[model samples]
Target: MRAPAANPREPRRHHYVPRLLMKRFAVERRPGQFQIQAFDKSNDRVFATAIENIAVESDFNALERDGVRVSLEAGMGKIESAAAEPIARIVQGGTLVGMTMEDRAAIDLFCALQFARGTGMRAQFSALAEGVEARARAIVGADARLDLVGDAEGMKAAALQLIVGSLLEFTGRFNDKDLLLLQAIEGEDFLLGDNPVAMQNARQFGPYGNIGLGVPGIEIYMPISSRFSLAYWCPTLLHQMREGAALADQRLLQARAMSVVGQGVTRAAALAALPEIEALRARLRRIPDGHLAGAAVAADAGNVTRLNSLQVRWAERFVMSRDGGFDIARRMIADDSAFRQGMRPRLD
Candidate 1:
């Protein structure tokens, strides 16, 4: 028989969502002690705790490889460190503007890591593994000498591999979308979930939701702070915006020409149109391999609520904010049975 895997010496409290990101939505409970208000969906309870105490699982990233036990916690820490400055800048300015290419890439990887490393994702992978094992067992019948699912160590190894691989896969896909920083309107705030990266497709509905990162109309939201959120707009949506802007400009120009004949109206019209043109350009434009803070948009109360609804739906267990405000989340849970289950893979 194979020897059992040894316990890893690495950090046990592995945080899937980085503490740096969580700290943005934290309140200073005491001197140098920050606390965030969290609502646990499982128990239907709201509580206050440090950011370090939540969004974590014991040895969640630990794995056995080459007869050695290791954890990906350190590697995850490095990703958080890389993204710290850029994200902090966005929170401070309440915009996604003026980020460097490297900063953008770092944030992309970090977001992917957050999505892949969550309990929701890990549970989905586990369920998939179980389903495959069940099918394999039935196919092999009594002739099977070993468990198709392999040992715990082997499973851990596989999970670790999948998490890292997904992070890398998603980073490139996230790069394809247009980055925007969304600011919550006055008297409204964004919420953070255990699974912070809330993904949805506005163009898709019914039993077939398009969760694919590369798919058009995919909307990805991550609340960086209670006041600001990071969003990735679908390429299709950006295309539509650009097309609409062009058509509007053309119509306005034609109308001006028809109304004012044989005057130097072209120059005056162009000058007058400069501000509108710049505004549209900022909205529809992006820096090559970077992000523009000018793309920041204000989210009205309705918009903020809509985004928070995603956080509630995407969260595995808890949805939190700077304050213990969960009126929307509470209502959703009470009204919809589906919201109680949150986002999970359909094994069937």
Candidate 2:
């Protein structure tokens, strides 16, 4: 006799990084079992676990709202389903060319949600709360605050509210950027961190410099699989690819001026009136209607290494690799004192 079916509403384990994605970096252990290599930064050790085991927590996305039991797992599952096909096609084709606008929107939403929903962000929220509490205590000189501060479940609910609230705004920023496919050369693969979306400023290397999503020269890197990682380049930097950096900066100023004046006019009319603006916009559009209808150029070794390093530095916990190679991570941890200490708040 068969046992009772599992309850969809009462899922115990929920993944921050959707398993649909983890499967790309996982190895088939047996007939249906899949496993991926994991490197724990705390212990400075490497291990492997089933794909379902890592990047998951119990009731991570489940919470109560207005006295109703609500689970976001189902909604997140829908997003995973929507993105699976387009992601598979891109991985198989090994390129971003010829992708439909609908597909681009799907992937953009997936990456944005992935960026917001994670243990890393949760930890950051917790740290920020603690910082605020410390300051409050200093000013008031007393242990007087709401119970929410120390209550684990309450904190989780608050974090979820913030995550879901700002999702659309974050996705908008992602949509404004253009995709730059970073293809790994033969025998090379990208690592997937617990906090998979690595946000950085390639132009500015100062430790405390601004790397906000809307800031100029911001680069958002998300590893799609072992073979491909998507680098969303800001418009200014994308312009810099053809023109020099200085010219790209100047062009952005001009574009901003046009954008301000073109507010009242319809987009079509504005483009019709401004030939130069139309040409610049056309150059920035990479996916649809672009001539790059083939595989993207393979990234150099240095590029791959730098991308991998971002995964390490930005990660809140362990980072995973497809081939169980941890030499790069190990070397970095051994040499860098900060890494050994563990992940700290980006500002602090």
Candidate 3:
């Protein structure tokens, strides 16, 4: 069997390591007074209210510390209100160092509580790492796309790797703003350069390939995981769609058969189909603005059985909702142990 993949982080070994977070925040800035704020909630703080007030700078490179600065453009949003709180990580200079929440119910839904029950490695990363290797080979070998490299399965695997490896280094959140980066760079290799937020330490990778467009002065490198379909799974699916389209130009056989994640027929399309995930959206949106994890059990005896039985379904829904629809489903999953059991990763 193929050896279990090594951890994606480079250096492979490190004397001092930063702990992986369940909840985090990030910042990015570009020219023309535009900026992108990447929020990484660690999938842990499921209940943590979505903090909204925000602004990104134009020449953000000039910031002395990370991206922290007075809001030049206060975004009209707030994660939670008083009396009922939310979990939030403080971000300064592009580092998430601390967090806050309003109540116990909120805490119950966060990554702290959902650590295992609904916890999982980021799916976008999982799929991409498995997909890119194939695509990369398609680009490298043979004179033409039709005359090109390997089997469909193998090409998908290579594409997945390249994508995942690139994501591990993305500093941007999965949002509309990231498209520019995707447009500029060539998906064939490293996203190139440093995190736009920090022109200094350059670990972040996939810009989706926006570099060729000439983004200017500050070279931004983002952490690859930060790039793994942030906010929701919709954009992740969108990225794959575009990738498939690119493959189509390359005359890839399977490109035409793409589907939403979890809804497809073939191994190539399995993760693409997202039917059940689509079904649970309405129920999920009811989740209070708190943590993203409190999805095992409901807070009362009345919710026990039904909610528990629905845990896996809830996770299925959680992965599908492009908006806040699955957030409510997460609440149900957090309160029920039976639900927790249903959502397990399948040990066998």
TM-score per candidate, chains pooled: 0.81, 0.79, 0.17
lDDT of 2 by residue, 20-125 (tens): 7788888988967889999987677889999889989988988755556667788878887888998898888887777888888888888888888877777777
Task: Give one digit per residue, the lDDT tens place, for model 3 in 1-348.
Answer: 333443343222210101121112222223222222222222423222212212111322111123332221111111112111322221121111122333322322221112111112223233344355446556786343442334443443443343334432231222222111111111111110011111211223344332211232222222112222111122333344455445434432233334322243564453343343333332333222112332211223233222222322323221211122233334544664343321222211
Model 1 Cα lDDT, one tens digit per residue, 221-330: 98888998888878777677767667666756665554456347765776576567556555554322234335567788998999999999988888888979999888
- How far in Å is the alpha carbon of 84 misplaced in model 1? 0.5
Task: Give the worst 10-residue stretch by lDDT in candidate 2.
Answer: 283-292
Pitting candidate 2 against candidate 3, the one with the higher TM-score is: 2
- Show pairs that collide, candidate 1: 97-292, 97-293
lDDT of 2 at 142: 70
lDDT of residue 134 for candidate 1: 72
Q: With candidate 2 superimposed using the best TM-score fit, by how many Å does residue 30's alpha carbon deviate from the native?
A: 3.2
Candidate 3, residue 26: how far the Cα is off, in Å? 38
Q: State the weakest 10-residue window (summed lDDT) of model 3.
A: 189-198
- The list of candidate 3 runs beyond 4 A from truth reads 1-101, 104-119, 142-348
Candidate 2 global Cα RMSD: 10.7
